[model samples]
Target: MNSAVIRLTKCSSTKCLAMFQLSYHSQPKVALDEGISSHRVQVGPHRLHYLRAGHGPHTLLLIPGVLGFGWSNFKHQLLGFDRDLFTTIAFDPPGNGYSRPPEKTFPPLEVEAETVAQFMEALGVESASVLGYSSGGRTAMVLAALHQRLVKKLVLASTHAFILPDEYKYSRSLDCIEETWNEKEKNILYGVYGKENLPKLWRQFNDFNERILKEQRGNICLHLLKDIKCPTQLICGQKDPLTKVENSWLLHALIENSRIHVYPEGKHSNQIKYAEDFNMRVQDFLMADEELSGTNIREEDIKLAKANSF
Candidate 1:
């Protein structure tokens, strides 16, 4: 489907606003498989873009990190999951990726969560397992809290409930993305955001972090964390520079039915760096018959699993 165009009609709900049209361009090179299909739908005031894969009883909703879209951040899960048993849907939040025209202002996380809930409603997804990576986790926390019934299971990867002063400082230091990001990372971002907008967006995101630090005391979804009642899994990278491993522990402590898994040498983007292991682990957790135990898994267990694999 070259030059694939998705026509999104305005939602017919009472709360929905006026109708708007959107033209979506699906790149041929990035189209991974026939099972994955890209689409756009009008959700309230925003035209949301998303990718859907598989057709099964179970559903997985993937929320990407800051400046991330559905395909770029979640290609692995979209392709790796068993299509016969589980369906995966990944979306671009308002003002990001193909969902735009409103432009991202970095609204409060609760508002973002509402948008997500609305998006799911528009798509007819009643409930699903949710995986939110990095900043997306903030929105996911609020979603699980505000719309509890919409989330069956929750996964937070390299994310934190709130930002620390040091984190804000680190964010400020990354204002010049060209200097802070290595070539490979920069290339990936450039492919998603383009050369002209990538740097500006990064700077704007840094400014947003600063505003949250000052106005909201860096609390994105800390107040809502305890309200999330779903079986939660927190994936942390031990060597992560963005979100410290301690943040995962904090999240585990706050969410009663939560557990943590640490990747010894993994970094912030370990979901991509360790895609196979990460995918298998998430699949196991999401597919588990019963709720997994809480707190961190033992180091010896991790070693034992690795040894058994070998």
Candidate 2:
């Protein structure tokens, strides 16, 4: 028997677009009635593939990294949050996963923000708390700015607001004209989490970075982040090599009623790596804070949500 060694890299090309399946070994077996449901939405030239799960008060709208999608990367999020307490939703942005790719340049963050608004409206959800990771975080900021009423609160993980001279180089969009995805590209994919977890991390990084670089324009993220006004939470790994600390400072300063949290030994993927702590902090912030809070959630209820396996 041979064990597969998946390698991730910082490649920005089309050749690295390999179809890899994620084994469901990471999630716990505590049945929570969490499965994926999909929908097709038209946002300008792009048709987005969106996923939804669970049910409760205060819907959580999850936005994944540039090209990341589905529940695999967001397993911690889906599993950690009290599914019976809050309705959680995650989706594939344009040009990734089951979603349609862009026809022209990738839609701007503002445009994508509107698309999200449209999605909520179509589903009859008046408002939701926006949660974004990586470039998705930047997009959430944009959504809050454009649809302030619909966005009650915001959460950002491993995201940057504006370009820093030092940090811009790390983004695949800034480094290349058109990113190509291939099996062999030396990127932060493999070594993002030291050397031991390189194989797993590499696949995750390559799956996201490769497609995002080819389809997205980096400036959209920078411009839209400056306009946020909702209560926001920014979480980052202290050891994140790509997004520097200064960017979080700038985001916190620009966005009103925003807070920042840094995991001591965490990296860019801290939310996944430190799922227990990360989920606890998020639950605490959303429930305790007056501005961000609405419905009351019991801690005991969170611990005991069960799936109806009928």
Candidate 3:
């Protein structure tokens, strides 16, 4: 498929204009349960679609990666977090999921971060504890660094501060969806972005990574890591091929008040594969009054976190 065809298939000018003009009245009501409700709001030029659950005092914002949407990436977190203690909001970034029309232009991470801040403001959220997965983590890092007061805490899962040479090569290899993704991965992506659009989106995402590598020297937010003052948690899978465990360790080293959790047998999609453990650890970190770092975490604390998860 040629670039022109892909661009047309993603979003036409007429459809894009209609989507933006009807933004206020086009929200469709979709509810998973009594607690989870789906909504859409206009954030500047983009219309953001999000899933909101719980009525707790604390707010948790979930940012998905690459071809990820709110429900596709954060099903476990949407259903598992204690409704009494936290209100979770998972959004589909512009051009992905239900938030479309503009298609993904792959702007700078700083621009994406600013859009996130605007999203929160549109939703009347003053501040939130943010959780970002994969590429979304890079955006989260930018958000925390540029808008420090808007983020209460931060979580980065299976992500990196900058793209490595190996990562760039791997991204290049993913141009062809059929050859790059496993059966399960294909099914998941197919469900979120239809079978026809999946390949195009994947290719576009790969191109975005390549641009970052060449133009920015793979730097997403490495220079801004030190500016992130919020208490942070870095979760990684030891066996992940994309963002390895070393990425998490490096993040922990750079972010002063940060801790690391490595899942032994987990892969790139560990958040979904190891949902129970991941949820517990994230909950524990967010709920803790004191900052949690590698130096302070203990065996009993782990047990306590597991106990309090439910």
Candidate 4:
């Protein structure tokens, strides 16, 4: 079938929510033998790089934290989850992956959020569920809170609603990358962000630990979190030093209709270590028939999975 133009009703504000029409041009399903495929779309000045797996009814966008790319961070989800149930897209925010930023100051939250919305629009997606890890999780919150119609459900792992302390300044200190990291974590970092400074396609993360704090300027989405009415899930490791388990509790407290999961003995990179269980839980949450919405936490929503000791 020939690809057709996606008509987005022009909105006065560039960052309009799911305000326009999306052509119901059904995306082709991925064959069982097919592997994940890379995709690119012009989102404003940046060209976003994302990987698409599955062609199911529900759309799920995976956003990664600082020093991480969606394709690398959420690979298991694309490979392991029931793709027939949901189409998943893992994206690299501007500068992190192949999505290059314009030459100027790095963009702030509003800009980043706009990029996400425009990205969806480019792909003819009126709205989709968003799953963000670490800093990207906070971005997902902003996307849902500010652009309500654009997100159906939210899954936030290793995310927080609070801003860094005033004294927190990062200069390749890997601050946003999480200080409580192991060698495996370091390898992931080096591979994703530091591979080719000027040597090739990776340079954005070479500048800071987390670019958002320094470059992006907008409310940290804390104020509008309660305003988010979508069914949300909050996840974190009990031992994540950068974003503590208590922070996850804070998000759970503020966001109504939210569930919380704490992986015992898990670190900031627990998502990588526990991919199977983590992806399963996320899929279950997204595909669940019934989810209660309120500040009240359900017994099952609270998971305290213990990590095995070495």
Candidate whose TM-score is highest: 1
Which residue pairs show backbone clashes in model 3? none
Off by over 4 Å in 1: 1-29, 293-310
Kindly list the per-residue Cα lDDT of model 4 for residues 11-100, writing each as its tens digit.
454443222211223212222224456666877767777778887999999998765776558767777778788888888787764454
Candidate 4 residue runs with Cα over 4 Å from true position: 1-33, 101-106, 164-219, 295-310
Residues 1-310 of candidate 1 have per-residue lDDT tens digits of 2332544344555544323223333222343465677788889877788888899899999999998878778888888888887899999999777676555668878788999999999989899999999999988989999899999999999999767777667767877778888887677666555677788888888888888778887666667766899999899899877787766766776677888889999888878888999999898999897865555655553443333221
145-252 in candidate 2: lDDT tens per residue? 878899888888888754444544454333331243332222322212222343333344444444444445323354454456677888887777667665665565
* After superposition, candidate 2 runs with Cα above 4 Å error: 1-36, 41-46, 101-105, 172-227, 291-310
What's the TM for model 4? Answer: 0.72
lDDT of each: 0.79, 0.60, 0.78, 0.66
- Give the Cα error of residue 58 in candidate 3, in Å: 1.0
- Candidate 3 local accuracy as lDDT? 0.78
* Weakest 10 consecutive residues of candidate 1 by summed lDDT: 19-28
Question: lDDT by residue for model 3 over 1-310, one digit each (tens)?
Answer: 1111111112344333211111211322223554677677889988678888899998999999977878778988998998999999999999776676666667888889999999999988999999999999999999999999999999999999867788777777877888778887687666545677778887887888877788887766778888999999889999887886666666776677888889899878777999988989999999998965555455564453333221
User: Model 1 Cα displacement at 252 (Å)?
Assistant: 0.8
Worst 10 residues of 3 by lDDT: 1-10
